[model samples]
Target chain A: MSTPRTALVRLVAGREISVKLRDKGFLASTAVFIAIIVLAVVVPVMLEGDTPEYTVAATGHAGAVAEVAVELGGAEVPGLPAADITVIGLEDPTAGAGGDPVDEAFLRGADAVLSSDPDGTVVITAQENVPGDLEELIAAASSAVTAQDVAVEAGLSADQLAALTSPPQPRIDLLDPKPSLPVPPELVIVIFGFLFYFTVLTFGASIAQSVVEEKTSRVVEILVAAVPVRWLLAGKVLGNAAMALGQVVLIVGAGLVGAQAIGEGDIVAQVLGVSGWFLAFFVLGFLMLACLWAVAGSLASRIEELQSTTLYMQLAVMTPFFSAILIRDEGPARVALSYFPLTAPLMMPARVATGDAAAWEPWVAMVIVSATAVLLIGVGARLYSGSVLNTSTRTRLGGAWAAGGRA
Target chain B: MTDATLAVQGLTHDFGQRRALDDVSFEVRPGRLTGFVGANGAGKTTTMRAIVGVLRPDAGTVTFGGASMTLEVRRRIGYMPEERGLYPKMKVAEQLVYLARVLGVTKDDAQARAASLLEGLDLAERRDDLLHTLSLGNQQRVQVAAALIHEPDLLILDEPFSGLDPIAMDAMAERLRDRAAAGVPVLFSSHQLDLVERLCDDLVVIHHGRVVAAGDARALREQRAGRRYRVDVGGTDAWMPALAGMTVVGSGPEGTLVDLDESADPQALLAAAQAAGPVEHFARTVPSLAELFAEVVR
Candidate 1:
């Protein structure tokens, strides 16, 4: 058996959820947001056009050069296409040549033409811009072949010659070990930060708007008489919070699925790794702002008056969002923001994404934000209960506080 | 069914420097329809609000059934504010059920009650429609239903009949009587003195945040009526003005309206009128509620 207050709160929350779910504006905006996330994920995969096939028409020694180029260019670059090059033999260096080397290469059914002069000058021609990796490969192959010829002429033994002519690769040793999880893309981290900011701000405004509507319409009079004021406030916050959380889950889930489908599994792992922290921070941060929004809403008797009354609260939610954007790279600023209750929701998740904050920082920020949220609820509930039924011109915060104390 | 008496004692409230309710006191007895009547801005709404715990009185107590009005007590009280309001976007039936459930009724019971109330209010067809879509009179009926959905122990309605048509008013009056018959104390405020007088078993007239007069409706009328009389003589009475301690207030073909001093005898006046001519009719005239209200507030 639930207490009357608890039961009433649940009823209120249920009503809010049902009403919002039926609201076409809310549904449409959520659909639009989901569409954007899906498009963001799917568009890049669609634009990564089919793999190109490269044919190099080579004559004499240059044919050997083309094979070496293909071998070196096939090595993987993290986010670019795989190299696929085929070589074709030319019996005479100038047999199929014309004044325009590019035209001659195209007539020979090749992407590029490669030839070596007897004096050791190598010429490469292409009809259009060559891919950066393909150019690098051709340069490296020509240098390697020249070095091998010199090594053989210097009278080195077969083993020594092989060692001298082969490419020299530098070995790397990190002083600190790399993190087990790959860093999330900076764009992805920024997206999460904005998502937190937009959801909290929009939902917080909605809570205030609803409060003012109830007050202006005078439905709150009946509501307050039927139940405790705190219960109504609790119900509203919980209801809107549930809706906001659902939206966040949908967006985050869609992003993960899209990333995985596009073969960006590394991003998926990184997002999942910080998702717990993001959710915790989002919940606490939204609660903290939502309480104040309830207070601001109770102060205004009409929806038209809401903007003037809730200006300070709006600024409070926006300040941290803009701060995160402006001072994103400043370690000290991010550290301070991650621990500050107001900014922590926006900054902490970003720091986690960038790997700038240590493991313990998020926990500390969580504790601080949660504590602040509890305190805000206490004060916010008092203000709400006190001023909710007073349908005067407008309720002053100071007066409401005094009345709340007595209440 | 428990009969509860709602007592508001010395309730005082202030809005900033101005007094909204000043030492107002009244009682809504069990199984009685108590009409709270007052002029506009006379603090009737404020007193009602204080009784239901919507506004905390600065210095007073509102007790229901001999205990202070707590959340538990308020749960059993149905209140409608002077400014009628409901969630415009919500369906009528859904809104009623929500209000009922919040007051501790079971979900199924709440739904049933909402349906019954809407049916009784002749809003069965509009139950599924959003509240704002109804005409103002019909919406007012829905507001009344919302108040009665939980079948509260005490019903406090402020200006419940303000926007209602004659038929709707009668329906609301009938509902109030039914609630009172079921042992629920109903306190409602209205500026319409005629309807209040016709519907109320008890009358509490408030003025300037104070209870000016309160008692049984007939008793209040009789009390305000005082020693006034109307005597119909068979012919034009020439000697009526000569009576001591008595003044003719008005005279017409039917009768002469007379105002007598408190010590004057009504029997003596009737005999004198007969002696002058055949007394066709004689009776004490009771003051109407509007007249009583004007006299008291004045």
Candidate 2:
């Protein structure tokens, strides 16, 4: 009796997935992915890498404010939540007599330099526009120094000077501040981008390699005879995609568990939120690339040919990956990448994680990706069926398509 | 025309700018072992592939039981492709069961049959071993067992005996005979004419993508044999008188083997030979399948 197509596909899929379960490469990569995720949250907290560091160079009376500047910067420089500033005191008398303080400051590796002109007008030098916190810091430092000098010259003791004067600094507030995560948003994008990039490349390429293995080994002859070509294609894509998704879950689950363990409840919730969308957009997106990767596998008849055959798929996987992270903040580019089918998988969920996506935008991107996946599935099947039987080891896509027409 | 019979009629196929099979036609009747003979690239594999639907012919129909080939009908046929298409990474029994299930056997039965089939092929001890771990000859045995696991209705094996040792060959021959004895049509291809002569009940000869000769093996040999007689008379030239009505095609040892003229009669020749001396041996000659194959292909 003839086997039902679905039944045979299920059988093939079961074998594929089971085979991958035993694969050492797959298992090793899964462990690596989990470690990366867990480390992304853990390393920064342990290192206390959150505080921003700055350096300033100065000389003379204008440079004298370095002391007061250090005092205020130590006690929470207003706009910068946690910041540290170091002032380098230039002792060369010639530095102020005939040299440019800005040039000297920059040569000394300072972010900004303070110096007094012969006319005794205080000057600050910075690149482009000075950063806001540093400007506020410099201005307050200048005022407090001037006040200290005036009060101290009146013959009051240092204790009396301290009693009457404290550095009163400028404070400003914003109506909207981006919500922060335990891990930076950029790190979140790197994690998401990297997860999609690695899983798709690894899983998709494996799907193709399996196809070539069947062909080169010629076992596909028996398989193709027993079942329709489409079923073989379906079984492989579905089975490997399932493996890829399961590994994603394990890696992300480990991440969430580790996050919560470290008391990063926010990281857990944020990843959990984006991953729901990640998985939603991811399942179909991975399928499209999986189909393309399968087509790549079918094009080659030898294991040697697989490297060349899979090149385009690697590029396809890479472009969107770099795009999602590198151009995430570029408005039109991010929006375009979010809507583009190949990139939608990475872009949509990443945008949501970075809090750039509107509520309804991911929904639209998901629909587009789902549709493109359907289209790629059809094209992949055709290319796969056509090229798979060519014993020549490599054939043009059009040739395979035409050949499949006859089959 | 019965469902147990396999028929290939006017089959044609081409592999871009080269014709692989052309006007091919033949039949494998039930309860017969048909040997398909051809040189390398002589369309033997192509015809087998076309029969099993692995390759679509440019024109022709492969029918079983008087109906056109279908997936169900294909399932009923156990086809072993020429290239030995079994997975090297899979365990022997697991590979066999998997192949059988794809051919429509239930998993439990497939497993049972695989175990017994491995036992029969003397591979029972290697059942759990991966296919690549086996010797080439053993792998060949497993390849054959792969085709028989489902106990198919018809058997079409391509170069099935190419790599078997003599003992393995006999075991396989016995198994094929068992299938044929059960009234299944068995079609297989081989370049070994001696083996074919000893084993095949039917023969199909192909050369240059065309079917040159086909039918019951004995009948084909007889059909191609010429009128001839072997005679001996006291190991002497005394039967030279018989040469009047015949031409000596060969002469040695116990006789002169002669192809008779139209007017020559075997009885007349015998009488003529005895008139000269005591006739020691007189018998008509029949061609062996090997000779007939050479003659037909030549």
Strongest candidate by TM-score: 1
Give the alpha-carbon lDDT of every model: 0.84, 0.84
Candidate 2 interface CA RMSD, Å: 1.5
The TM-score obtained by model 2 is 0.82
Stretches of candidate 1 off by over 4 Å are A45-50, A55-66, A77-81, A86-166, A177-188, A328-333, B1-3, B233-246, B260-281
TM-score of chain B of each: 0.94, 0.95
Clashes of each: 0, 2
Worst ten-residue run, lDDT, model 1 chain A? Answer: A90-99
DockQ of 2: 0.51
For residues B195-237, could you state the per-residue lDDT of candidate 1 as single tens digits? 9888999999988888999889999898778788899888685
Model 1: how far residue A123 lies from native, Å: 6.1
Q: Can you write out model 1's per-residue Cα lDDT over A225-333, one digit (the tens) per residue? A: 8777888999999999999999998998997898889787987887888788888888888888888898999999888889898899978977888887777685777
Off by over 4 Å in 2: A46-173, B237-239, B275-281
Error (Å) of candidate 2 at residue B15 is 1.9
**lDDT of each residue in A1-407, candidate 2, tens digit only:** 43688888778888889889888888887887789878976776777746557788877877677667777777875553445788887546474656755666677778877778887666877776666767777777777777777887898888877776654565867687678676677777787778888899988888988998898878888777667788899999989988888988898899889878878888788777777888888798899899899999999998899899999999999998998878857588788889999888888888888788899999999889989999989888988888887755597989978877766
TM-score of chain B of 2: 0.95
